[model samples]
Target: MCSSCVMLFNEKNGSILPEYTDLPTLQKGEILVKNKYTTLCGSDLHTFTGRRKEPSPIVLGHEIVGEILELAQNEPFYDLNGNILKAGDLITWTIFAATESDEFVKDKMPQKSASLFKYGHVQFTEKEKFNGGLGTHCVLKRGTGILKVPLSVDEKFAPIINCAGATAMAAHRLIDEIENKNVLILGAGVLGLIASAIAKQKKAATVTILDIDDTRLENSKSFGADNVYNSLNPIEELTAITSKFYKKGFDIVIDMSGSVEAIKTGLKFSATGAQHIWIGAVTPTENIEINPEVMIRKLLSIKGMHNYNYEDFINAVNFFEDHFTDYPFGTFIEKEFPLQETEKAFQYAIKHKPYRVLITI
Candidate 1:
């Protein structure tokens, strides 16, 4: 077996470095996957740059896709349709391993357990240590939600499914009538793009997007955003657009911008009974000032979601397969790098801020 390499914390400072290590042995019901593609997510970059706090000396990539190397003594592994999983099938699993049936687990928010364990976030441990996708192999915890990559979907679409795509699915779970709604997406990143596509597919009346990057906003139109705005000109631009776009305001507001300012701005333009989803804001930061009267007066339904459930993962996989022709999901992977170039890959990702930068193993 090849040596397992992990992105570890440099003891001197908080900077990240890769260290070669031994592979983790799988426990019962667990599976050891040979990671093929590891996408560097915004959260990963944030953790690296000290923008987000994590139990350090951790392997950081969580948007994972890979081949199965060893499956524990269990036969229930299968695709979304019950097709049994095999050794070579490419698969992606949720970032969390939330299987305990205790009340904390049954409360419907598994990602918030007191003893919660997540990939790409926790500190390295001796017992089942290789948990992140940056390593050569990862032992999927017993309760991790798994799904097979459809043959029709290109491999490039695999990594982001677990993070951006699945989160989009989970966020839109309450929206039943997208066609009748005016959708607004903040931040034209991966999550924003995927949400735009999903809203468009549901036949939203109008889709508007906000971002500072002209290129991203321009490209968003093809991804289902009918109108795009530049947040750089904060006050004037937002005021003018909000007044003309929808006199009654937007029916749905999806916030994928990590900035708290967006949330503050979003609350102002939410229509009555609108569903406002908070999917970004992963790191702990200062609280934004907002008027409680706004939410109460608007009668808005506000929801915050982190990782997705098993069903959403399946939906994301199916969406990529079905919508590949209309939206180039693969274009999100702007560049690919070998495992040894992991550091350089992340540097490239931060510097360019491309849709996504993949570290292909």
Candidate 2:
């Protein structure tokens, strides 16, 4: 594991340059995975733009699917039986930090964070704790494996399930609890499109998508949006549009773009006893005032969904496999670039005009 590894780093702001790096030595009970495909998450944008920072000279990327390249011996990676573990099996994880104790997994929240933060490179040495999917391979320490990706699924799409797809699936799962729900989602990005697909698959009475661009709205329809509206005024546009489709306000509202004004106005269009799920990770400094009385009077329910759990990941994968066309065909769009082009990939992902921009290393 001491051999040189290649990774992207932010030595300067707003740019990423590939640097030859040393592969991290395996810790006890840890396994080194040669990352195959990693997706640049929206959170990676925050870090790139200096909106967020970890320890300097760190690798960036979290959502990844990889193959185990090597395993620690002496204390073999398998169970009591001497099973020889080999590489090439596709796997996906929540990418949590490795913990020596079992107590972390016992606590749900800690376990979740640990799973998501495994690629953190707190220090820039061979102990690359902040390392993530932007490299040739990533180290997945023990106690963090979520599920192995089935060989039947496309490896390219695996990363999406962990982040964007999970957000969509989580929102849909929450709405599935209600009866004959009508979903109105803002923003026709990949998350919004995936959410609309799931909502329709769950037999939502109506799934209406709102976005300013007619192209995105058309894409939303292809992803099972029952109707599409190109409008900026959420309250007026949603009320009018949804009324024409369901003759009532939307039974649920999902804000994927994290616009405060959009959220506030969308709140008014939610039907009585409706559920509103917030999946977008808005900046912490942004603040919005909501009328508690209006929420109470309307019997509205609002929930916040972060990263999806193991079950949600499985659901998204299954959804893609079973209903690929029903969902947006180009959800995983753009192109695949080798590891060296990571900086270019990040810029392309942040720009508009595609459902998802993926890079394969």
Candidate 3:
């Protein structure tokens, strides 16, 4: 029997106090993983500051890497490589744990469908309390797509694969291909930075990023952004500067900032037969007006993506395996906080605007 466990409980008013709960007994189709690293993402910040509504007193976090603690016997479960999973293996799973088969899952878009049981976005009940990466141990229920991580991938950089890396990979699917295309990215956050690097690796001719944070913009340089611009400038000035690369607009536009103004300005620069991907508006904000005529004239296609599917997660792991050693991916983790100091870590990340503040379990 498992004993009492500790987790960084989200108290909303900027507190991640350590809370204790009894661990649930493992059952068929259930697996338990000891937490290694849990990422504090932009969504966590929104929930921390009360901008996003969530169940109070819940354990909050989803981006995670953990070691297999226990697994159900006789359960038909396979890792990404079709290898049978066993205890002591390092692994991560998709954020969405589908409760039932549905059309969406059949269509390969399980991120937001089919009786979702989202890690870190759920409230704990008496039956089973821990549900997120902030916990000492997290439950990976049935239907979760578990993937094995090779020893080559550092634990620090692997957690973001569930969120940042896969999300970018999903967004990249918006365009037919990235090679030789001129790409524009808005926001120098984790997703934008990774997508930029991935696009560059795919041979994008010119990769430009627009963001207000100079520090983050500078950080994008190492990640594959060919050019960085301050979006704080007037829309026309931003347009003119971006236009110098391609007079009309880029072949592909990716918006990770979710700013209405930025979207409006970015739309103007998309070339004929272009693809625009919107991913960063994870939170609802003020809506902006746009001219549909541009879509009509340029034959532009806009795609909006949320959390990624399982295949993207697998691809993310491959991307890390190929590039983790070469790029400064691990450097994004600026500081680490113990499980109990999650509140402090969130505050530090907010104040310093570091690439990411991690919860090291």
Candidate 4:
């Protein structure tokens, strides 16, 4: 069988070439999936705009949802919940696959394992042309963490569960608990909004979000953000607002903006014994200085998460399935394009800067 796909020939040219390749025979423990919907994530935009570089002729999309097309013979495949997988089931998988022997797995950072194979970032070859979300099909390799999405979950929203949603779950995991805590999320993007909702659901005392975009901050209110601030405002104004609600400072601060200024301001808002989780600094940027004396006096704990682990993915799926109706997850994707218009989709996403842009296969 042949599958259609769009490949990035060069980052310098920013051209996406459409191509078709013969699907390879499924290996043991591998499953073929028909791409249903794929969303253009922030990292994908970075690569397309040459802000980040990836190998040429690579398929670049990781936030994806698909349906099982075929299952390898003689080997039983199971999802993260241990349920047996079969053809026709809707599913999504971890962005990277790691082996048990991976040293990072022992260190509890499987996403950075030595043998990690990340989907959507690999250079396309004849044998693995369908390994990314921009293609009509994808082959779930061995050791990949798979999840069977429920029929009730919208196809458009499911694609993000494995990426942004899972990363938010991982950030919260680092905080350990949220009940009765004042939580402040930096950035009102998808990750920050999702984090706000999760904090409220976990019984946080207050949930606040900060973003430069007023529109996005308004949207945050519907997603469980009790207070929203435009960080672009004057520093004194922001400080006054924070003083009004966060009298004792926030007990938990999560940075999803990757902005040095935002992180610096967030650090100042940290209450004594606060926990800070940074998930959005995946790219190179200017560093922000921190005072060791302040950290020592406040007893702040800071941690960073990259991609997510299997457990985080599972929690993300469950959270979406349980609370899909509670929030407007559908509104995130402002526009959609077909596989043939994948390039246009990226262009629209870049120009409009919508929360997400979808490519349906």
Instruction: Judging by TM-score against the true structure, name the best candidate.
Output: 4
What is the TM-score of candidate 1? 0.92
Residue pairs in candidate 2 whose N, alpha carbon or C atoms collide under 3 angstroms:
5-21, 95-115, 96-114, 96-115, 97-114, 119-130, 120-129, 120-130, 121-129, 121-130
Cα error, candidate 3, residue 70 (Å)? 0.6
TM-score of 4: 0.96
Task: Give TM per candidate.
Answer: 0.92, 0.86, 0.94, 0.96
For residues 2-58, could you state the per-residue lDDT of candidate 4 as single tens digits? Answer: 255555455667789778666778888788899999999999999998888887778
Put down candidate 2 lDDT per residue, 132-213, tens digits, no spaces: 7877777766655456665555778778766787668867777646446777898888788888777777778778887788
In model 3, residue pairs whose N, Cα or C atoms come closer than 3 Å (at least 3 residues apart or on different chains), thus clashing, are: 249-269
Runs of candidate 2 exceeding 4 Å displacement: 1-4, 74-86, 97-107, 110-116, 120-123, 176-179, 233-236, 245-247, 329-331, 351-353
Q: Rate the local accuracy (lDDT) of all candidates.
A: 0.80, 0.69, 0.82, 0.87
lDDT of 3 by residue, 72-125 (tens): 877767886798888999998888787547777788888877577888888877
Lowest lDDT 10-residue stretch of candidate 1: 7-16
Error of 1 at 299 (Å): 2.1
lDDT of prediction 2: 0.69
Candidate 1 Cα outliers beyond 4 Å, as residue runs? 1-3, 11-16, 74-76, 79-81, 234-247
Worst 10 residues of 2 by lDDT: 76-85
